[model samples]
Target chain A: MSAVRVWSKPARVVLVVAGVGLGACVLAFLGALFLHVAPANSVSKQYRAQVDWVVYPEFEQNWKLFAPDPLQRNVAVDARVQTVGPDGTVVTGEWRGLSAEDWAAIRHDPAPSHLDQNLLRRAWDFYESTHGEGDAQAAPGSRGQLAERYLERIALQRTGTGGGRVIQVQLRATVTAVAPPAWSREQVDTAPHVRELPWWPVQDADREGLS
Target chain B: MTTPAAVRAALPRLLTTLAPYQAAVVRIGTAGTWGAYLLREWGNRRVLYGDRSPWSAELNDRLLADTHAFTALSWSDGRWWFEAVYLLALLSAGAVALGWRTRASTVLFALTVLSLQNRNVFLGDGGDNLVHLMAIYLVFTRCGAVWSLDARRRARRPGRDPAEWGEPRALADALAAMLHNCAMLVIAVQVVLVYATAGWYKVQGARWQDGTAVFYPLELDYFTPWPELSGLLGGSLLVTFALTYGTVAMQVGFPFSLAARRLKNVLLAVMVVEHLAIALLLGLPFFSLAMVSADAVFLPTALLLRLGGLLAVQGRAAGWWVARRSGRTGGAAAGEPVEAVAGGPVEAAGEPVGGADG
Candidate 1:
């Protein structure tokens, strides 16, 4: 490469010092990054907060892409809703396969949009992580309620406001295991397991765009 | 060995602009990937980031407030705000990819990447993470030095030498070069960490150990965008096992192979092909594109130069055909600057085969 340019001797020295400092900072950052991304261990655990401060938000790393084990099951999100007519007759709607639409949009398309690939999946995952087996808030007042809100927005937006004034919405997932090839000896139960979530009452905020 | 005279002699090497092509390719790669992805998702922008997003602005704001995270999306939950940031991201990605006003655009590139990706972190995959990291690192690089519009501006300048510049300008240029080298170094290290960690995690999986990991994902509805194509590929148990074992081997051995040029090139080629397969088979175009581009950081300058040459030749032929059809002459104009890009800096003293530069 052509030389960058020339600086005076003292200028060179100062720049060199600054460069050295920058290098050290980068090294420190890399160390923190390694700790943050590495599987939980003693040293990383010891410096958890410090590492988080450095690694969270922007510099955070997650290299575990289909690692340790790839996701072996197909989880499809389904939603249903209750609606009130002009005569105050409440109607419970059929469970709509929200995720089935996603798969339909995805199938045969080489470049599926993030809306189809991640919106329902990630929202459902958020809800799953925050809620317990009984559908109670696993960590109430933190992010559980927020996760529920996120899921409700996604599912309601996909299924629409139940043909009239919406009253309540509920979601569930059908997780089916991918069957192994005939040649392989590996045997996994190819059964579809359905998990129903608690019904969340439709809020004023949920009605804003439903019309 | 540590004499003052020797130290003084080598001190100036710090200011030398290193890996200009690597920087250019990375700039092009990351920005191209991001720009294409955004365009591809333009129809779904509202759902991905705007009002239709499952994670609403108020939710994003609350989450950001608790985590103390950084996202311009949290600035306002309004559709107008989301639209503005999305537009800016699209523009920045284009400008950075084209290397137009590169310094400012690179900063914008970083901001847009962080703002968009961090807004709804769960929406991304492994490739998004790499793009996220690269956008930040690319800011610290003098990535516009070669194959850039900025480089063309410099080439067209009255005096094309930094040495003839004013004192302050020269000093800044030197300092910038030093920073660029360091940034490139860090980028290289980051890629190594990614591979090492991925490899480490893969080796621990029982399916990976038993050589069946690659076969399972191909059958899943989510990953199987092309079921027939996937079925054809996954039909052979031997082929599946080979791909499985081969992936594990390549990833784990990648860091060690870096020091050996041929081995590294082979690994890089495999990685690039592997990413291409991921894009097609798994239907993760953006992720695979991001990864392939990130891997550009490790490519030697010579190979890039050769590739640039081939592209330039093709570009000239296309230009010639267009100009002929338009009744214009001098199609050779398109081929000239590519020479400047290839002949850049005379390969920089040939620091070993493993050096980031030629």
Candidate 2:
């Protein structure tokens, strides 16, 4: 007299069918995840075409969780917006701190979400990894294009409305040197290096509501 | 009996026989872990997933479409709708944590997590992926079979034969049991894979090979929460090198060590200590907690029960002392025999009050 005996035959059938269906789904999902994270061997690549979609957005992950080497430099993202004045004069704003906002969000909080902790830094990393420090055009479908789009949205969100239509946007990464250990009396260069990108014309797609 | 149809019939029975109480433990661990994460990140929900995100709805929609990831956020058009979904996700997570209607709640919980994580995919780390996978797998497991409201409801049924409740052999019960066993195995394997990959990757890096990798992170401003402590630890090259190599060895040995019970227990203890250190030193408590919860699946049920027994014995002794101090006529409260409370076998004391299975 099992618990399943309490249910009618039809009910048992329905439960079994649903359970099998769910199990299949889980197996497929896990398979896709495995393929996505598997080492880049020929076998893995063969399955990539079939399972790439399953890996995207959700299951796609980077295993560099404090591995190899931890972040040695503290990088901050900064933005400057060029606006038109009432007299139709071009006005350049000061370097507004974008990463500072992230820091502020999590300053007093004990447990900050991964977004507050890594979003801005990863966004900058994304851009840097795709497009090096140069005025190279972002190739279509490349991660560079995606990174540009992501940064553009962040710049627009930070700038906000009410300011005269922003004509141009400039993004930069400020990398500060971390202090060396006391034992190592190494005189490492402590200067901050600023890598600035060319000002891109603000397109309608860059605007929040317009997009 | 050797035919395919007979094999199919036998498969369910095999699975039922093989099913252990481990799935219930994994369920509670995962549910508790994710529940805590949701609560911790509740205040920052807007920044991470809501309208306040730098990644706008249109951008999120495009990403979702391109990635073909399904999320409720894409369907949500307004701020209020998003907020409503977030609230529902929180409540559903609470329900799953309590193991109320666990099967349905597990499904809902996974969906909500997927929706939120997909909405802002960049706001995640390794722990998020583990949590995501575990939530989905838990849906296929018999998570509500033990230590759950559903279990209590089954026990309290009016007019049921008590013996029938102990060993359920029906088709649906067998299937559920099979699924639970399979899912628990998958979860254990998943954790092992994560560690193996992480360990192997570290072995390839020059800095890690040379043992200087740990020192660099401690020196970094981003990870140096306590500068004095980091400095003190990083000052010693021997200590840094030992820690670096020790971590690598433990992680690489974990999968193989699982075959030996004593070695596995020792490694598990070491791993827990390592994770605790990471949580405190690196300020990544949530991630560490998630990993530790996943690792808890390896703990043996017998060991957990013994620990529980020790605690019970201590509690009864304290109770006896309290009774003596009060100068009560009867040494035992409620007319219960003192020996019954003090000298009963662990099994005869009551139902097993522990979690996990080796």
Compare the candidates by DockQ and give the number of the best one. 1
Docking quality class, candidate 2: acceptable
Clashes of each: 0, 0
Instruction: Say which candidate scores most in TM-score.
Output: 1
- Computed on C-alphas against the true complex, the DockQ of each candidate is 0.60, 0.34
Query: What's the distance in Å from true for residue A110, model 1?
Result: 1.2
Segments in model 1 whose C-alpha atoms lie over 4 Å from true places = A1-9, A138-140, A209-211, B1-10, B165-167, B328-358
What is candidate 2's lDDT per residue for A81-127, written digit by digit as tens?
88886788888888888877766665435466566677776777777
> Highest lDDT: which candidate?
1
Residue A23 accuracy (lDDT) in model 1: 80
Give the clashing pairs for model 1: none
Candidate 2, residues B79-105, lDDT tens digits: the string is 788898888788877777656788788
